[model samples]
Target: MTFGGTVLPEWKQRDTRPGAHPLRQSGHGQRFGGPCVKGLWRRAVVVGLALTVAACGRGGVDAKRIAAADGAEWLTYGRTYDEQRFSPLAQVNKDTVGKLGVAWWAEFDTDRGQEATPLVADGVLYTTTAWSKVYAFDARTGKQLWKYDPKVPGEAGFNACCDVVNRGVALWKGRLYVGTIDGRLIALDARTGAVAWDVQTTDRTKPYTITGAPRVVKGKVLIGNGGAEYGVRGYVSAYDADSGKLAWRFYTTPNPKGAPDGAASDRVFRDKASATWSDGVWKESGGGGTVWDAITYDPKLDLVFIGVGNGAPWNHKLRSGGKGDNLFLSSIVALRPETGEYVWHYQTTPGESWDYTATQHIMLADLNIGGVERRVVMQAPKNGFFYVLDARTGALISADKYVPVDWAERIDLSTGRPVEAPSARYRDGGISQQASSPLGGHNWQPMAFSPREGLVYVPAMRNRGFYADALGFKFIPGAWNTGLTRAQAGPNTPSPKPATPPLATGELIAWDPVARKARWTLALPAAWTSGVLATEGGLVFHAAGNAFTAYDANDGKALWSYDAGANVIAPATTYAIDGEQYVALMVGVGGAPMGGDQPRRPGRLLVFKLGGTVKPPPYPAAVAMPPLDLAAATPSKGDADRGAALFGQFCGACHRIGGLLPVLPRSPAILDGEGFKAIVLDGALKANGMAPFRRYFDEAGAEDIRAFLLWQAKQPAPAPKPGGASHG
Candidate 1:
């Protein structure tokens, strides 16, 4: 049985965990023992942690300093509160970029998705890797200072909708905050990786995940969760940074009981959002609408923006009885940061049925439209539309398709709704449609905006969707709850091969949010790509497949390129130390590792500078797997067919044939039936993320799944590329 690796039991840990909160450097210019260090000496020493006596104001990366958008420090997740992801540093501009080469690189121990955006402050670069691990590095030389692993129970891996990846961490007064995949929000002392406060944020019994990074607004740390696909209610929460106490929470969906949840969102959910959802599978599946990603804070408006995810059962008819527009699902909502009070919202996909989640990316900007300067909040959600909305009131300023969207012909500006095609819902019948499917016109990859050029760089995609409802669907707790037929479910399925293959292509679009259109587009041979990074130096950086490249932000010109040695799903970030600008990217593969031969590469931090030369360590060669013998017990007539259906429903989400998880055909367990039954049917390997399937299947079912793998092993296919999974 599996024993270690982030899977520790802490179900009873519901209260705030107290720890040391020593004074830290804010870097805002106060003396060594000034007002910043006046009176916190006793508190610092009490917790057995050494305290620093440096410049401290409110003692953290406060609102004013972040608003300055300094060139040296990348304090916040998106560099600043606006989430523009545009670095102001220009030492390595277009004219000097040709000399750009690798300065330093750091490889992570975990070999899953590297989605974290490294946060740099005062010359220290901090980032998180898979399995909710955090690390601190020297920005200039890439020296590792410390690493902390949450040790989230490996069984919690069953709860993750995507791979076990973390977006990064949030920094506060001398502390770094991270949310674990198993629903714990923890704060670590920045100077020394020691626990300050730890709080369990969700019902441990339910399938809830916190893959997204935490954000700090005012004195509270804000975080949301994933697992809408599994059965759980969604909410964005706030905790006191110093004490780790619960401040408030805002549920994205409503309580079916129609009673107040005693939450900050009680009033709005009761009067507005509660009416839209009906009471069937919706109630059973917790009526999904998790705020998995895209939480932005607007200091000017004093509002926190949250992008909400898809409904629990993605099929609208199945979730809400095919009736009212699910008010908050697939929406961008505004909330008062202090009290979690609801302000206003703009739903991107009304009654969303096609997994068109609005929780892609939300960026705040000031745009000039029709001779007026407007403070706008923009998003290019999963449904293929680019939206520009009034930041203060959530008014629809503009909405238009940025990709080929057949689900909706156009957005009705007058009504602020999509003029959806009738056949798009599959209400007439289960049909295949050519559009941007759950692969999304865009997924969770972070986009970047250049205020200097008035453009938002979007890593856009196009795909086809085949939607069909699962007949006689039963609500399974903490399992794949999308109510989709097995054929259309799992990573193995996206769209069938069409006679024409335009949808398979991806692109980088220089999108003009004000014009509601693409200013320029760069088509890519591969549809799966990485997040974008824009710079004031007239450049945009992103990784397509394994090649990381930089392009001119104004006209989309490829200026520099490097072989990242693997797929990079995370966005690139730029920061400067000692007057030199550096671009750092986290590289790995996860989500849905696009099918094909993949090269095995380590999760890495690759940094670049204008005139520095450093080479990353060579990747270990991919090992070839011996062909499966399957000489033990044989399969029955229909065992392979039954196993094919069963694997897609259960195993396919993680154990893709050529992805991150174990490639079962070559796995030793395939040759050991008794061992396979122990691991699959019994709870033998439950600690290693192989959760017991006895709850859903029997020994015979386990054998059937094995039969299906043996059948696959017997088939002829491409030599295992043995590498990347193009995922989150």
Candidate 2:
């Protein structure tokens, strides 16, 4: 069995840390001495953003509008700058929720993932779909006003580590801004859908893709990208809202050259961050700390909180020689929005290895703990820990496991560090972590906070990430370099089966952030689930499988349910137009995690209201897969075995049978070597997002992969993998 990092040649490590604690029992969690925090030393007053807005008119999205969390419109990504995602509107209360019905619907052309949260302003509803297309609708009648397409090159689809999905768009001073999946940030006239300005956010040559929604703060548009797993460095950028000029940039990882980048983050890297790393492929990969999603702004404290993602070539030793804390990877960092200056940072997973991104949703709140009022920033990260930090000082107020955590015993509050389990590093031998996997317990999906219920609603899951590394690990420039061998991901056992982390499952957790524990839990039925929406109506809205359900905020009782008739992975939003309140969400088959071969439904925006009586049209019939050739030569067992291994490495990511791209098992392109070479090794389908794999494998290897799929196609589909459980 290959221990992921330690088994590599030319590897050496030392435990310079003091609190390397032992592992804990399987599913339960224990807390250490978590100290109560004092007020922040520096309490900056709100500036730049005046608390003024015309909610009914075109006031545009400002701090005042976002912070108000008004009922008329969803002005920003999280409804408010605090990112609480809690709607103060209560028209559809528990008593009235039974009358909620679909008012109207709008459909799109693409079948890619639907994750964007719609924004409503001036009686117009604005949202985005897959491929960075933007749309506007009559908030009251669902009339399509205008739609704008960035026309992202189809081949740019290959650059996305996930599906080519756009979370949503941002509105600033009569202009709507969207960051394309191809890395272009463009601003458009909100009324006419005309282009105002467009700027390239990243070097188009690299594998960077923007999946997060842009946040406008103090006349600057803040945006981030995702591509860490594909070997790109991570950073958050700010642009002048009116001119599309570069405002500032804060790089999460240190510069590759070990010299000043002449950027805003250069000073911090030289003083503290640069030393935490040792020479390795990370320097080349920039060590991956992308602010892929979840950027929250606090006008009171004048800080922008950005959640940072995992490292490149994810195995710690493989990335950084198992060196220092790997400053900023899997960490929560607070920055000055105007200049992108670093204020303070809290590392969640030091020396992050399991793709445990601190880049999940971060919501800000004020809580009374032991009668002491403290302003806190909270997150339920992939590592399965619920962290509550003093928002201003970055001090840990308290931390506890909201889910089963086997990686570390608990967080030592005094040191602001986890008492990580000793064997977790796998330095001495191979081991499996029951709960913490690359698909974190809590992924990038946004969580909702209920000020009324005093609980944080989280979509939590337990996914077993196989940790054994490949035999002769090498970093590929634009590929998933997490160190797991293709054989490990296959159905066959690469190592002995692991225990404690049971089969994959998911639940909706109502956590008490102040008390640092789960208040209540609701077991969900789908392998895939949507982000949550909590409202003052004493109700919480969420989607599981195709059934969207509403639950009582105080208790976990199911209040009402609706049939969505398609998979929905985006969070729900609430708004009021012309005295009528509406709840809406985006629905379409998304990501491979919904298990393979989902129904083919067109992407759609669904709006609901009390007493509304409209039904979305049924989906078109699914196309059947063609049968395989009966006259083809039967492959020798050796040929098929080699094909399975190669397929696991090169093809399994998107081409699983009955999966996201369900045209693989009986693929016509693989019927002959000539066709296989063109489609697999050449750029025949590159426009369709299937980039030629010639960089990683040649024609012979592609033929072997073809043989493997033919073999899988001849039989019933294998049991669905747990990978789709939750990566949001």
Candidate 3:
């Protein structure tokens, strides 16, 4: 998620995302119009009339100008400076939220995922699509206003770890700012979509990419890079909003000369550098720290907070000497917004070896803890701990295990350290099973904080994984490995066997931050990925797998539930216009490591509203399969019989012959005959984990396999079984 950063755990070099562009700002120099006047006597008469109207509340100074006293419009990244992902407008209260529906939706004219939250202001919604192209639309009607493409290089896709989606843009003064995937930040004129200024955040030749939205605070535009998975050092920087001049830079990890060279404030990083990181690990691991998450700011405290991502290579022994806190690797940092000076920091995981990054949520709130009122920074790190710390001083008030975790027994409150397990640390050549899995207890989708409910709701998954050592670990181009066993498949490969775990259902937990306890919990049939959103009407909205539901925030009562018919993986948001409220979210099942494995077909975006009758959207167009020549293989009765016998012998472990089924790499429906032939005949199948069928079957034997496959496909879909059967 971070830009210009190295990959985790092992510090192996990685390729960066392309399309991240440079940013700039525009000022209020043009006077469009103002009040008109005549002579003093005439002005006096007009003033008297104005005073009368003002007294009636119709002619007072516009309150829109007053609201700007803090910050104008949610133009940057994730709404406002704090990135709370919460809106102050209460017009769309729970009472009337049932009427929420899509006024209109812009499909963006592309199949790229809609990960970006639209920046709304001045009746226009500004946002970026996949590959970092910016677009503006009339907020009320979803009419296209303007679109700007940064022309990111084509090869940039190779550097992206996930899909080529941009989270959003930042707005300052009258200009729009965005970071491209290919290591540049650009600023555009809000009125015309014209480029004003652009700057390179880093050299793309090093394989860095930018997917995070740039944040704007005061008069500075701030941004971070992502490539920790690609082995790049991470940093956060500020630039003059109007001129794009570099203001200051803060590197996440300590470097040679102790601090950044040639800066007055560099001395602050002295002495503490070596204390936080072990010797030789920095040079070997490349100090992986990518701050891909959005930054939050509190004007009252004059502080900015950012959630830092996990370390590189994801195998800690290779990154550290089994010692050192690794400085700020998996920590939330508090710094002076104006000076970029580090005030204090709380590391979520010290000497983190399990890729459990503390970089998920950054929620700011005022709570009463232990009879004392305190301003706090709250987070549910991937490591499975819920931490509540004093916002001003970084003092740990409470730390609790929020999920099924065995890596650490408890957090020592006095010393702020974890009670580690002997096998928790990864051994270079030994295999170990760790609880809370590499997915952590949670991932980056984001959680919701309801001030009224005094609760935080998170979509949680419980998983377990095993890590085994691999030899000759080095950064290789176009290669991805954590210096660990491939597939987490089993203790061995090639002659591999399936191992099962106690898979559990996903849960929606409503946590009381003040009490530090779960008020209530509800379990789902499958893993949940969407975050929760609470409204003034006392309803909490969330989606998991194929279901989207609303619950009473007071208790975990399900108020309304709907089978959305698709997996809801992205986070959700709400907004209102012209006294009517609306709820918006994107739902689909394809992207990343999980996408290819998920079963849902057809991606979609569904908008729901109460009392409003709207027809469902048409499904995505079906892809056409190319023609296949099966006759070229030449099949005889003997060959067919032999192929079927061979399939039964080698693939029957995971494949079922009837009710009937085919032994295909993917689902039977996703492939045609030709596709199946290529997979069986070419070695590409085995290269990516699917075993090679040609090893034991001849051309004639392959015909028998094809016959069975066709017969399976032509059979009617199976009836719903009363009891679910497990398949490995």
Candidate 4:
């Protein structure tokens, strides 16, 4: 039977003898005594074969199957429960990598960042884009099979501290799980991309958001949230994979009233965590500690390791009266997967300030250390420390500084605590410059570990920050509660004089966990680049600026490179189909700190293999921003200050003074009040991904923002320092 305007060739039959008798024809149908019977039999056979193929295509990816994945498929965020992000397939190794070229490319509709790590399983490729849009494609070809958009409200953009981004999705039995930026966890049919179950994972009334990928452990989907800077308590929730029912929750911080939350973390909070806080202010500030990223499950140990975030107000004096270890903040906490009960924890940054979050990357491996094989959990947290801990007990095995940092002298191995520098806190109200800025030596980029080489490939950063207490700090609801003035915590400004030599750049570091030192370093053109991918083929791949390059796994030597026409902030994943291996990555810009200065471009999924020859579409040239005309407005400092605050609330997430987005002080549109209104209030630039903020700001507010931009334009440009700092 033909359906949907397409002919079903298999269903058609040819008759002999001029159709003398349908049953008498010399065909298989004749043996059945009628053409109708034959047709039904043939159809049944076809349907049976189709069902068999479909079943084979959707392999069951349970915990047991994932544990035995063997890198032939990209089954999870890190390809396995260990989150090693390493592949055993090595067909396209260092020798053949030089001939790698694009095999197929699929462009996305959105121009925002593409931070997803595509999951490849059963010959299907699944990934997510900005705004939590999920898609599935044929692994061998670039044919799109299905797509799912959660239809998140546009107004929800305000809740995101960074650009609206969804890290990726999780695959369970026959469902694909994703955490939306608006704080919803959704499960989709693996074949059809239809919503199977949907659950709101966070309080909608608060500013909580979810930009990380969901992880399924022991039949439950685990998800955490962001927005510690907006005054909400942080927690990680688990939902039943089949019914979407809340299984349990573990709050990362203590309650304000000292009452039990009646959740899995109640006892731990009441007994261990609550006392670590200085009651009054922490109760009010939610104490930060958002478990926004880096969740890994150890199937053997049955423990879930959650990497916690920084403090709420950042400044200790403001968040916790300048005291307290802040129990879970900036720490790696181990929890029971089934019950969400706290097991043990290791604090990476005690009394965490300076946005030194432990939520960078986590991997598990068995390593030979000091003449013994150790089961360890490895992490390169933001505070410039690389730590190895016993995954089962959460005991610190070794800690070392992987990057140059001045905040603390070193981590004391005896006590597993940092020996803080006296001047690191900036408590005396003077501007204190700190190495390894709040952006972190390493951020959300996933690192790769190669058991063959015994080295972890890290995307490392080098930057500095200036922290100072704000004048008259007061909590502002629905806004950044950093407790520091904008000038102090704002974008990085060049130092007038050198306290130390500048050190801001990006590099791919091959780190030896045993030796605690870098083996070799490959300098990147820019910081905040994409994650790393290690293959058994002796190749390591990474994306930076607009180029995706592959290097020798043992030594940092460039083997192949491709200019993808846009910045790639996502890691690359490799999978095999029909006995051939392929590497895939999403290309675009506009995440947290990078790509704001670069022109917004449509996102694309690019795949590569040896001798493949498909070219990516050319990206549009960046538009030259018009210069600001300060002669247009003469507003008072009070109006300018108000405008600055409004700008922070609205524009600061994407646009900084010298970052990727168009700098307001240099934009010629700000020279004309009407033009500025057209862009901001009337959506003149909506086509370019700048959504109209008419509902949030009126003409008066727009004018105030314009006045502030004009005031900023009159000031001298800060001198460029050797090192650069970008937002996370």
- Clashes per candidate, residues 3 or more apart or on different chains: 13, 9, 55, 7
Candidate 2, residue 48: Cα displacement in angstroms equals 30
lDDT of 3 by residue, 646-678 (tens): 444444333442111122422543234456556
For every model shown, what is its TM-score relative to the native structure? 0.88, 0.88, 0.74, 0.87
lDDT of 1 by residue, 323-397 (tens): 888879999999999999999999999898888998888899988899999999999998998999999999998
- Candidate 4 segments whose C-alpha is farther than 4 A from its true place: 1-59, 488-503, 591-598, 628-638, 645-653, 659-662, 667-703, 714-725
Instruction: Give, for candidate 1, the lowest lDDT window spanning 10 residues.
Output: 20-29
CA-lDDT, candidates in order: 0.78, 0.77, 0.60, 0.78
Give the higher-TM-score candidate: 1 or 3.
1
- Candidate 2: misplaced stretches above 4 Å? 1-56, 427-431, 488-502, 591-596, 620-646, 657-659, 712-716, 721-728
What's the C-alpha lDDT at position 651 in model 4? Answer: 73
lDDT of candidate 4 vs native? 0.78
- In candidate 3, stretches whose alpha carbon ends up further than 4 angstroms from where it belongs are 1-82, 88-97, 256-260, 263-265, 279-281, 488-505, 525-528, 561-566, 589-611, 621-728
TM-score of 4: 0.87
Please give the distance, in angstroms, between residue 637's alpha carbon in candidate 2 and its true position after superposition.
12
lDDT of candidate model 1 versus the reference? 0.78
Error of 3 at 290 (Å): 0.4
